[model samples]
Target: MNFKELGISEDIIQVLKNTGITKPTVIQQESIRFIKEGRDVIAEAQTGTGKTLAFLLPIFENISPNINTVQVLIVSPTRELAIQLTEVAMKLKEAKDINILAAYGGKDIGSQLKKLKGNIHLIIATPGRLLDHLRRKTIDLSKLKTLVLDEADQMLFMGFKNEVEAIIKETNKKRQTLCFSATMDSQVKKLAYRYMNDPLMVTVKKEEVTLNNIKQHVVETTDRRKQDALCKVLDEDNPFMAIIFCRTKRRADNLEVALHQRGYNCEKLHGDLIQAKRERIMKAFRNADIQYLIATDVAARGLDVSGVGHIYNYDIPENVETYIHRIGRTGRAGETGYTCLFIDPKDQRTLEEIEKTIKFKIPRRELNI
Candidate 1:
C-alpha cells in the first residue's frame, strides 16, 4: 500500500516519490500505525524490508520543528548504519527544517560536540558514543519523545545491552519506544520486557521468509582451494555485482589482495579499516566501480546496497541464521539473484543445519572449471 494511506505526510510522500519509493513494505505498513499512536512496538523483520523508514516516518510525523532539543533518539549498532539512517532521514525531510545529527565512534568527537551545540531535533547514534555523550551531559535526552533501537539484536550481540539500558534510563519514561530486530531472540525479548510498556510484537516467521527469486548453489572444496573455487564460480556465473563473505578480517584482507593481484575490480571491508576508507570503499562499491566486495560479518551488517547480483560464501558462516543474513543481501526487490557457497568436508554439518533452518536443501553443483 502507499505510504500516504499509512498516514505519511504529503511532503514526505512527495520526497519518497522523488526517490522512487511509492509503496511501503510489509514491515513499514504493519508498524507505522502503532508508532503513530505512540505505542511501544517490537518489529521483527529481515534486512532490506524498509524497517528504517518504518520507524523514521513516524518520528518525522510526530516531530516539532520549532522545539529542537533532540526529540527523537535512534541507536544503532554500527557507525555505518547510523550514518545510513541519517541519510535516509535527511532525504525524507527534504526542505523541511528538522535538524538531524549522526553520532558514532571512530570519528571526531570534538566535531560532534560542535554539532550538538546547535539545535538538533533527531540524533541517530551508536550506543557507545551516545553513552559517552550522556555521561558528559553534552547531549540531553530529557526532551526526547521517542527512542528507537535499530537492529536491536545486533546491538545486543555487540555487548551494548548495558549501554542501551543506561541510555533508556536517561530518557523520559513516558517516551514511545520502538525496537526493530531481525530476530526476536531471548535477549531482545528480555530487553523489551524490562523496558517496554506492554509492547506489541509484530514478527515475520522463518516459514514466511521468501528467497524464491534467488538461485542458490553449493561448491564443495577445501579451505585452501576455496579461493580458486570462488574464482571459477565468478568466471562461470559472470555476476553483475557480487559480495564475498569471509569468516575473519584476515581472510577478507588476504582475499582482497589475491583478487586485486588477479586484476579483478575488488575492495575489502572489515573493522580494521578507518571510517574514511570505509566510506570510500562503500561509495565505490555502490557506484559499481568495485565488482567484488570482500567483507566480514560485522562490516557488512545493515548495509543498504541494491542490485547485488551474487553472494559468495567463501567461508561458511558459523550458524544457520548467519547464513540466512548473508544470502539475504542479494535477491532484493524482486530481482533475480545468485548465491555460490564454498564449503569443505567439515562444513557439511553446518550446511545441513542451514538446509534444515531454511526448510530446503540448496542444489549441489560441481565446478568443473
Candidate 2:
C-alpha cells in the first residue's frame, strides 16, 4: 500500500513521492499503523528494511510543530547512523516547521549545545554523547513524548547498555517507546519488557532477496573500447531501465557525455553536483524519465529504485563485494534482473576472484567492435 494508506499526513506523503518512495516496505506497512496509535512497538527488522521511515513518518504525524521540547528522542548506536537519520529527518520535515539535531561523539559539543538552545523538536543521538548532554544538564528530556532505541542489539553489543538505560531513565516515564533490533535476543527482549508498555512485536519475515536470480554475463573489452561495448549491450538488451556503474566520477561524466552525444536518454550522478541537482536527477531517474543513469559508486549507494531491469558495469569494480553491490541494485523484490560486466585483460584477475567467491563462472561474450 501507499504511504497515504498507512495513515501519514499529505505533506510528508508528497515528500516521499518526490523522492520516489511510492510504496512502503513490509515493515513500514506493518508498523506505521501501530506507531500512529501511540502503542509501544518492538520491531524486528534488519538494516535496509525501510525501518527508519516507518518510525519517522509516524513520529512526524504525532509531534507538535509548535510545542517543541525534544518531543522525540531517537537513540541510534553510531555517529554515522545518527547523522543519516538526521538527514532523513531533515528531508522529510521540509514541509513541516520542525527543528532536528543529530548528537553523537566526534562532533563539537559546543556546536550541538548552540543548536540545542533553539526549539529543537527531535534529537537523533548516540548513547555516549546523549549521556554527556544529560550529565551536563544542557538538554532536557523531561517532556520527551517518544523514545526510540534504534539498532538495540548493536548498542548492547557495543557495550552501551548502561548509557542507553541512563538516557532512557531521563525521559518521561509515560512516553511511547519504539525499539528496533535486527534480532530480538534475550537482552533486547528484557530491555523491551522493562521499558515498553505491552509492546506489539512485528518482524519483516522475508529475508533480503539474493542476487542469484540476476542474469549475468561478462563482455571482454578494454578501457578504450568499454563505451562501445556498453552501447552494443544497451542496443542488444534495450533494458527497461538500467544503472551503468563507473569506477570514478570522471568515468561517469565522460560516459554521460558520450551517451548523450549518441542520443541516449541518460544522466550522470556523482558527488560533484550540488545536492539540489543530484536530488532532481534522482527524481527524474526514479520516475523512469531517464532510461539510463551513469553513476559513481559513492553517489548511487543505497538507492532503492524499483523496476531496474539491468545493471551495467562500465568499469570493473575494485573488488568482489563492490561487484556484488553494483549488480544487486537490480533484481529487487522478485523481479528478474540482467547484469553485464565489461572487463579488460588486466581486470581478469579481479574477475576471477569474484567468480571464485560467488562460485559461478560468468559466461563471456566477445565484442567484434
| Candidate closest to the true structure, highest TM-score | 1
Tens digit of lDDT per residue, candidate 2, span 197-244? Answer: 999999864236436568899999778888888898898889888999
TM-scores of the models, in the given order? 0.93, 0.64
The sequence of per-residue lDDT tens digits that candidate 1 reaches over residues 1-369 is 778788888888888888778788778889897899899999998887778889998888999999958899999999989878977888877846688878898777677568657688988999988889889888899878999999999999989999999999999888888999988899999998888899988876543344667789999998888888888888888787899999999989899999888888899999999999998898788878889989999899888787788999999999987888888888775677788889999999999999997888899879785
lDDT of each structure?
A: 0.86, 0.84
> Clashes per prediction?
0, 0
Poorly placed runs, candidate 2 (over 4 Å): 115-118, 208-369
Q: Residue 51 error for model 1, in Å? A: 0.8
Query: Model 1, residue 314: what's the lDDT?
Result: 93
